[model samples]
Target: MKKTLAVALALALTATACGSSDEQDDKSEFAENGTFVYAIPADPGELDPANAVLGATNTVLAFAYDTLVYSDADGKIVSGLAEKWEAQADKVTFTLRKGVTCADKSPVTPQTVADSMNYLSDPKNKAALLGVLIPAGMTATADEAAGTVTLATKDPNPFLLESMTAVYVVCGEGLKDRSILKDKTSGTGMYPLFTSVANDHYAFKARADYAWGPGGAKHEAGMPAAVQLKVVKDESTAANMMTTGELNGAQFTGADRKRVEAIPGVRKGSAPDGIGEFFFHQGDGRAAAENKVRGALVRALDLNELRAIASGGDPVPATRLISLAPDPCRGDSVTGNTPPADPGTAATLLDETGWKAGTDGVRTKGGEKLKLRVAYQTSAGPGVQAGMEYIAQKWKALGVETELVGSADAKYADSLFKDGDWDMAWVPLGLSLPTQLVGYLSGPGPDEQGSNFAHIRNPGYEQLTAEAAKKVGASGCEQWTNAEAALVENVDVVPVLRPTQLVASKNAMLEVIGGVVRPTSVRMLKN
Candidate 1:
């Protein structure tokens, strides 16, 4: 009787195993069978963590790399490689996670963390965009025995964690080859790069041992075995790919929004607009220092119109440097203060600066033509180009000669500052936290130790930025408020509207993830 019962139990177990196998296959039909394809609008300019300035490159590279900590959709810092941290009076200690390895199979160590931070903070590293992440005079040290690192700052810097959100740690060995920055990436992220078919075509496979997944990530990730990202420069191409099932996800432009939303299985994700502006080089010893001319340039701009041009007909206009989300300081105050878009004011200011009209009908001051060259990174979108052309026309009506110079991506750093040949240009500044503004405001330039880009040196503004860096919570808020106001009143840049980020995905093949889904988040997805 015992033998007969055992035979029956074995049959039942086999039947149960068969049923489970069928269920797993049914649930994973799309993810298990197919490579998740994505259509990115442009080629990722750089994959190196240190050199990726454009959003497109950062979006893709971030998946293969990660910062120390990142805010989830709810804007709270969850762990990445470092499990948790403690901040004492003089030292900040981060406990490193174990079992995580880089794409090249190198283990993540405290020394690796220290080297990455040190490189980012070094002025010689040409990381001006990342300079804001380090506190002035801060030094990094590693305790290998404890698997911890302590960062000591000369002064009490309030936004250290916020800064770390931008600096992704890399293994010392991987960084020895900086050439990868120009074309590919290698980091210790959940996804590892597998192939680079071309400039815009790449693929990655999930690392089975990815230990630092964010809190509450879908267990198992049901992670796709393979992922593909395709470069499609035109918005229409990306939008079409979403409909035809060629792309599981993409970022949409104004032209693609209506059509993309019309698709049955797609949803949209949005991010705060990046700041855009027409920069005037004040260090050139030219007319940039003339207050009336600066005021006139400010008065002639219609921000509402400029916003429309910059967003490719998306009409959201920004009034201040700070975004209008959460507890932004008096962002509403700017709504009523923007200067009128009147050419008469521009002409009057030019007259006051002694730039009277000459026989050629162009403004002339001290034998120099009122004409100035306006340069922009050729990589800037159609909207940015349109905005520049509009401003050139308005300035021309006021007897100003404006010549537009377009530059390639490689020439951006040199053209903007090093060549020092430009009079004005449209440059975008990306500052994650309020304190990072110091690089543009007070840091030494290439020739000098500090960069006064706009040649804007207000002792008051510098002091306020410094004070903001020292305090936390309410005290920090107060200092930032003062610094923000000083910038607006001084007319630092033309103060064009900020830009937004848009990501679209197909709903049928996969579930849309939630929260502040950046392009980096999109790249890391399997389904």
Candidate 2:
């Protein structure tokens, strides 16, 4: 039987059923290749979704796990493990899809779903998804007899499901002992972990019995029997592999995509991705805490020029944090919100803020010279390091000393959270909805906020998001947009540019969705 995927996600809670139909295709022309070769920028350490904070981790692990709800290319929630779900101000009810099994072949019940929720909601577990997607004060109750799991949140969360796309549901065995996640696999997803080679590659085998997937996507003939993530750090090496068909797909962010596509038997998978930016650390003792200082630091550079040289003009200055397809509040929040770079205004702002210019051109407040430490991840690419240095030079021109430091790939998260070493940093965090950023903006500080790396505390934003959370979908768009605008206006976040992520595949044979390669969706014709 063939059917079209659901548009508006059907909600079936408590004795009801979501009337979703599957669009089936006869596996006549589609070919099942022996293996699908993939190349990524770097190894996102550990497969454990709970402790993994990197976006690359979520993007890769998504192929190995299933969420409660799935999203379309446009960031709209469809259905995943749960047939349909109902959301409320503080409560969410989910109706489980029967016969879903874990990667280990264990039956997934309503209780199994409840356990995953409870584990993620616990504050002590330190799950990165906490407060980012699941929220802070969350609890769940499972009624196996009714086949429903009700999740109770402390407050209104309009975009919970949209954010939940990052919450990869796992079984109790791995949930209880998260350390096993580094070595073991457990989830009712499309593929299971097969073998992993240190700093080199990871292989996964497809599951035959699995059926639940985003928008009811299921395994078919063209789906690869196995998938390999080959970690090639160099851009040219990965690009050359894509051209040679040694790798089926490789992620390309810069103008290098053109070079790859220039070779025969190569096509690009293009989509919107979050930008690179320097988030101001506004916590106490942080140099960029004051709004005026933050403003000066942002106004010191011509962002267009920096992005041009750094990213090969492949990036668009961000308008909104969530730039995915089908976004409800899709508009230019960055244009009017982000001001034009003005060195004159920057100089003036610094002077008015009690920082007097010294003979060395560096400003001094009392006796201490105004110097800011800007940290960025080396793993982001050489372009990021070059861009940070460029911005640092621009700051020096404004009579402010800037220290451009790069964190090693291993200590990326620690430099921001553990060490408290950076005064400013380039960290791009994106979600499907505006409300997803609420927790990161109006939080206490980084030590307390699981996702608020900036340590931002905007009181007005708190009020706006609280009010908006009471409404759903576009009903709350204006409020959420205004709240984000406040962050830009106050110089809490000065985005360098939004990235237009591009990937190259051999002969355009692979179907990558939302910047992820789901094994279930990939089609390979027999060569």
Candidate 3:
């Protein structure tokens, strides 16, 4: 679960370009058949949807696989593999669209979708999206005659249908032999894997016969004949490539954003990546285990300054946990809910909590010096590094000895969950639905195969979320907002900033849904 969260977080940080639909309606402005080339930060190692945990892997998977359901730009559930779906508290039923076929020309049956769901639901498979997308202990039953797949969960899931949008259904053959999926595509998507060159590029050829898409969208004249995702690690290089027409689309977040935006023919857009949040380790034997200590830690640092530094001077105050597009609940749960930045108050709180400053300026409680290990992902770039350093300096002034631990994306999850080496971490868990975050904010720890890495045990949060789960979809948003406020008020997690990621495109217009390029939304324009 830690690895899964880490990989998903990487997806949130890396931005992708999208375009408007104004030019999409004109068939004369469209290119009949041409390859659409784009940029990805890293090579998606394995192509298997079930085993994919890296953002790069998921990015590639999105091109080759189609989910059970599709989430439109407005966060509405639309047609995909399943034309229509009915979601209940503990049960969800999907009616499979007729005449759907996999990459191998195999028929995509209700049983096929059921098998994929059951595979992820089973803990023995060890798929990364087990509890994240597919609910834990979920079972699926297929009614082939009715062309429907029914899912049953042990506990009620309010966003059951919305969650299905993330589950990429695997075909029967791929389910039997998972190794073929490592580098090949097998789902009923618009494209199939054509070629894969590790660390270089992964190419996909569009399925001309394909007609079913989100909201019954079909492969038309403007759609690309093939899609190529090139691995370009440097943001500047990607931006430069976009300028020269070498790449059709690419996302830039660093200093290269200005360069990409300056391109004459390129179309640019922005999307909310996620919140720059801080999570305190509430595990036993940790100083942050105390609520007052957590509050003091939050109060010690100037969040506004840190937000500016972290977002590279483009800071947006985060209100809710669901920052990504098509967010079901858009209410503000952050304002007036967290502790304000006040060094004096922080010192006083720490002193009141029995921590007294010594001659060396480091506070001590019961002969133990106040020390903290702050961990953050190095791949988050220089801005995050500066932000983490800024927090350390502020804590140092507050008489707290702080050690900054910078880990790469791959090792960040282990540092937080497996090793339990850090006292606090700056890892943003982004999701479209607030119900999806319930597990991460409160629940079992890593040892119990749960995503609550911080080991946060807030009764108020748990109770509010429990009630929120009972309500269906956005109707429970008010309770969900209050639930998030509980975490903020308790200092369980501090959402500091919401950063906007920029993406530029040339000769192509694409739509970014849930922070990824929607394949069906790609329209190659005539240059």
Candidate 4:
């Protein structure tokens, strides 16, 4: 029987979902075109949800896996693998769907979902970013008879389901060997990893024996047949590939948007989030790494020029450590109206902090040159290099020496991050959950299995985040407000700008969901 109710709901949303566009010529490489080629900025660093936080990796892998719950375009949580859930008192019960299998042909179970969340919650795991999604003392349990799983938390976590999107469920068969994720990913998703050409491309084949998709899902068990994600890091190449029909969809910057749409058979749409920026390292023992200096650095940046160099003129300067999504962090309330970019102000701040300019105009304090070794991840691409160099020049004017390091290697970058070799760095921080920002502030940072990349620890800031996590969602307003205020008070990490991510798709493609906290099931219809 046709699910008329589900179809009607989808049709209702079509008004907002259907994007306006100028048609472009569509080309393809498949036999009668059963394959779709997608282009993104980077390759999937890892398929493991517990470790892999890159947008490209998650976006491509989402079709290959299923999570406990799903998030909508507006950052709201809805049901996914689970049919329905009941939250009673302090315990929550989740009813699982039937006949689900992993990509490797393993059965899905309540234990599987619970085990996956547990794995992500473990502190011993270095790459687990999902740990910050939940409260510190939450336990997950499985009930076989009811096909349900229960998560008991010490306190209320209204955004628990929203956080579950990051905890994508996997096969429970090999829970002991976590290394299976490094090579193979097992989940009850639409696509399975058929081939992965590292740094080049990856191929996913639709599961023939698949079932158990939610009612709102656009695609059923196996709709696309085969999904291909190509790594065309260059914007021009990706646009060219999309035009020639070698690729069906690609992520485009604001700069590429005009040119991409100018070609026939292509359309451009905006992703609902903000762009990434340079996260200044302001931890202990670093000379002149004070709040005044951090604020001064932000003032020195020509945000207009930065935005011009970036995809669009949309420069949402990160006034606070938190993201630009919520309106509470904007305007003169946090960052005073017109941030001062005066070199005199910056030099004066450094001078008062004991840093004196040498003969070379580079400041020094205690016989140590005030040159900061700003190391941006080599994998950040050429556009990032250009922006970093521009910022480097701006800092030089303030008598501060800046260094730009490039490499596509994450391991090498991880080594630098661990050893604290970077004075200031351009790192992509995944701040989906509100607490994730707090975790980056005072919790055991990424280097210590926490998100605190700045390695900043303040008791006051830590308390604010802790209090906020106790009540998420609408109720978390006070906690988040206080925490955000505390973070900005110190100016521990100066937020350069928030980015509105860019995604591109073929003319035949029906829809592309943007601003997703975690990659789930996104469908491209046969338009």
How many steric overlaps are in each model, in order? 11, 3, 0, 19
Model 4 alpha-carbon miss at residue 97, Å: 3.7
TM-score of each: 0.77, 0.82, 0.93, 0.75
Candidate 4 local lDDT, 1-527, one digit each (tens)? 01111121111111121121213333432132257667766776767766655556666656677777665544455677887887543456788887767766777788888887676665566434534455556778999888999987776665565556555676754465777777566777777778888889888887666555433354442136677778877888887787787876765554566677676646555443433445557667775357667767766777567645542455655544433222222222145533456666777777778878899888888888877777764444455667788888898888888776664544434534455667776654434445545544565545555445567766776786667666545465566666656655565544455554445565334334322212223334443
lDDT of 3 by residue, 293-397 (tens): 999999998788999999998998888877654577778999999899888899999999999999999999989999999999887889999999999899999
Q: Rate the local accuracy (lDDT) of all candidates.
A: 0.61, 0.69, 0.83, 0.59
Candidate 1 local lDDT, 185-294, one digit each (tens): 66877666777766668788776666675542321533455667787878887877888878877655456677887886465554445456665666646787665777
What lDDT score goes with residue 165 in model 2?
A: 61
Indicate whether candidate 1 or candidate 3 has the larger TM-score: 3
Worst 10-residue stretch by lDDT in candidate 1?
14-23
Best-matching candidate per TM-score: 3
How many Å off is the CA of 444 in candidate 3?
3.6
Q: Which of candidates 3 and 4 reaches a greater TM-score? A: 3
Off by over 4 Å in 2: 1-29, 41-46, 55-60, 123-128, 171-182, 194-200, 254-256, 281-290, 323-329, 354-360, 365-368, 409-415, 418-423, 431-436, 446-457, 511-515
Task: Itemize residue pairs with steric clashes in candidate 2.
Answer: 3-23, 74-325, 74-326
Give the CA lDDT, 0 to 100, for residue 241 in model 3: 90
